[model samples]
Target chain A: MFNLFDLGKIFEISSRSVKYVFILFIIVLTIGLTESLFLSPEDYKQSHSVRIMYVHVPAAWMALGIFAVIAFLSFGTFIFKNKNFSLISKSLAPSGFIFNIIALITGSIWGKPTWGTWWAWDARITSMLILALFYLMYLLSWRIITNKNSANKISSLIAIVGAINLPIIKFSVNWWNTLHQGPSLKIMGDTTIHSSMIIPLAIMTAAFALFSLLIFLMKFNTEMIRIKSKGLDRL
Target chain B: MVKKVKLRIAFLLALILSIILSLFLILQSLEKDVVFFLSPTDIKNLEEIEKKKIRVGGMVKDKSVSINSNKINFIVTDFKNEINVSYSGSVPNLFSENKGVVAEGFLQDRSYFKAVKILAKHDENYMPPEVKEALGDK
Candidate 1:
């Protein structure tokens, strides 16, 4: 008598929190999209295609951001011997991997029009590829290890080691001259970007963050439920 | 217990340091110059035309295409209008007549696109973004 409808109870627990998050997500998205799309004047150079930045850059940011979170969770599990932290890390893997893939794909698509090439082995590109590989390895490690305790120990170590790649990815462009262009949104001294452009970018970033959080929450809840139901069935 | 606590503190410190470092790098990248791609129509409307290296994209109009030794000549069509394009470098696999392409460089004397590089689609099914934009206009 496993009814899929029973899943609705999961939604009921934090319904208020979800609603508030959703509202905030929508507001952020609206502001970001409007600023980037309508209000921001087209680049004196790029024109309309510059709009793709609203999507491409934020996704790239999140791809890196999620991995950072994963590293922290992995470290916590390793140091504190916390199963909950390990579960959170495991839950985040597939989504983080998917985001990185999306970022690379969109980046390639954007690069074709802008860089005149679909693929490049530049520092940023190469490091991001490595990050994607780390994600795959993390997932594979989870699958291969059958013993729960041993798997947790090994995976935690792997996650910590893989975190080294994050710093390399972040500094790749600066460390080496590469085809991949540097950041254009947030700078230190001189930001020539108009408020119109910045606003949409901010909105899109917020939307991306909310979307990631929503997915994480949903996935975490489902995993918990599955574990609980399996235990009940055993009883 | 004290050793474990110290290790946990160290880990947390490392995490915070990494995040701040990433933020700094991203901010640094934002300061670097960014280039843009443009089509012929965009060039016509642009005010500061001389300063930027813009990408001109369209199709190589049939019959307007010519070749001499190393240089190639052709007219890029936007369906409703067209512009002359000339390039001296190796063309991409997708360069052909009536097919979409993007040329990177600058306009010479407001007449011909003196392309420094040429990019072409790899397959028949693919359309360049500039072409898609133009097609969307109609």
Candidate 2:
């Protein structure tokens, strides 16, 4: 049972799967791009500007999803005292941070043409900005701290604290009068988006998820190799 | 080792609970201030009017828009209450009758507004022209 959780085993599996994931990511990405760019009809109002949603929405979702995963793994690290958990969280952070920045930039670009402003201090927008800051602080904490145990503890604490902002971000539009619109796709409610738009959005989201997983596997394998080279049995 | 791990997990949970409580209280206290704009009803229910720059957001009343040489006049309504807004600058492309809008400016009186900027707010529903036509939605 313990061997199932061993770093070597994790590394072997990730390294083996990276190429397959990459090939699948490329295939999905090509289909997703073609669908979103050409097949998906332009918005009745926003027209071609609405195409930005394919990238912006998926990037935002991945950023939020990755951060949630990090926070959960950090909690697991504290309980199990598993260094592997922290290492996995560490590997996940860079992709999450990159996605966060991508979401913000793409959102700003989309906002300029649609909302008539590049940015606003709306509730949803502000909460997302705060989340990006949390990601930044989490990344910086790992770099600034020298001691291994202390670094893991501090970073985990930051992630746990930052988890508080996740619901705030999710509910910001509904909770307050924001310039941003309410969610079109709801898990428990009716989806306002049409099937034509939904198909591309779904495909693009899957492509992004696969891409992030590929990034995670590469980063995780590199960390494991580093540990093995140093002759450490476990993290 | 098990006892130590259990204690650590308990402490982390307590910390999370306390932090959540603090955040809830803070957000509750700052509720009104955090809102991006006030609806017409919200503005009407205010205790006292401040002579400050504020934003009023609502739908542009159907067929209430009138454009002059440079100035444009429109009525913004929340269906229960309405405020008449007049602006001199160009409005966003999305600004039109029966669409959501936010006007930033000063309130001249209970029923009048002087807008410095007009921002069109689109709803979450997205569909192509053909789908909209098929559904007979405007």
Candidate 3:
């Protein structure tokens, strides 16, 4: 028997992680919101609308990063053939999708004031939309499929397959006729944005990431309750 | 159970192979669709200017921009080749003469492009990675 999916052990550890979430979220909120509203300089061109970057960029990062995490967790399911990985993936899905929607909505809000249009068929936007659809479909598979074993197996496959969009989403602006600007941060080069802006953005990203952890734990607990009700341990 | 394990392994291996093959084919086709937009010099080097929409990126060619009330005209050059672009819209605030810009639309001919969208660099001295890469050692 595979012990990786042992529910009791997982819960014991996760509840410990939960203890830190509250304090982390408070810190997350204070740093980004305060800096964004106060310390950050106004864009010489975009002006105050530039503040949207503090939210939009971080949310988009969560959207992509969390989906990658889901896919990685799904891969673990296949390797270990354990239900725990699927549960984690399922728990992660809603938060990832929520962030994806936030990114798109914030992006459109930012676009209207800056890019002169709320929507475009630019490659980056198109790819991100596709990614959101992939997330939706992954969640739907888990909902629509009734058999626990088959549902878990199929959704794991879907999650892994959908990961094809990850690289595309990352490279779309670079590889296509996109109006979206390429990333300001690069591994090999200097950060393009003003140093004043980076702090707020980093804080926002950390806040969003912490918020995801809070949601993930709640969802994981729900999944645990679900597994107990189903009584799959007797199998 | 041992026999079931062997069968499952075979099935999964096949599934992974097929997925890999399909992804390769999809990306191969997407290769044609994702232009990442072309450089001005790439536009100039095209054998025949197709009717399909295309994107061109380059500097705004210092002093080549002409602003009218509605339509604006400018020259986009990669320092090697240039294409004259005509756009009808409010120009982006960062749009100036000599900064990097990418325009998307159709090529009227080899030397002229009619653009529907104009994108300018976002931050100060922040060049799009594509533009910087295309510019090479310069």
Per-candidate DockQ values are 0.05, 0.81, 0.23
What lDDT tens digits, residue by residue, belong to model 1 across residues B4-53? 86887687678667866885687478532222244566566656557466
RMSD of each: 12.7, 1.6, 4.8
- Docking level of model 1: incorrect
Consecutive 10-residue window with the lowest summed lDDT within model 1 chain A: A1-10
Superposed model 3: Cα runs more than 4 Å off:
A4-6, A12-20, A229-235, B1-17, B121-138
Q: First chain of model 1: TM-score?
A: 0.83
Per-residue lDDT for B46-136 in model 2, tens only?
A: 7878599999999999999999999999999999999999999888788889999999999887788899988889899999989989888
| CA-based DockQ, model 3 | 0.23
Q: iRMSD per model?
A: 11.6, 1.0, 6.5
- Candidate 3 per-residue lDDT over residues A55-100, each given as its tens digit: 8889999999998988888876765576666777899999899999
Evaluated on the second chain alone, the candidates' TM-scores are 0.59, 0.91, 0.66
Taking the true A–B contacts (Cα pairs closer than 8 Å), what share appears in each candidate?
A: 0.04, 0.79, 0.20
Which 10 consecutive positions of candidate 2 chain A have the poorest summed lDDT?
A1-10
Docking class of 2: high
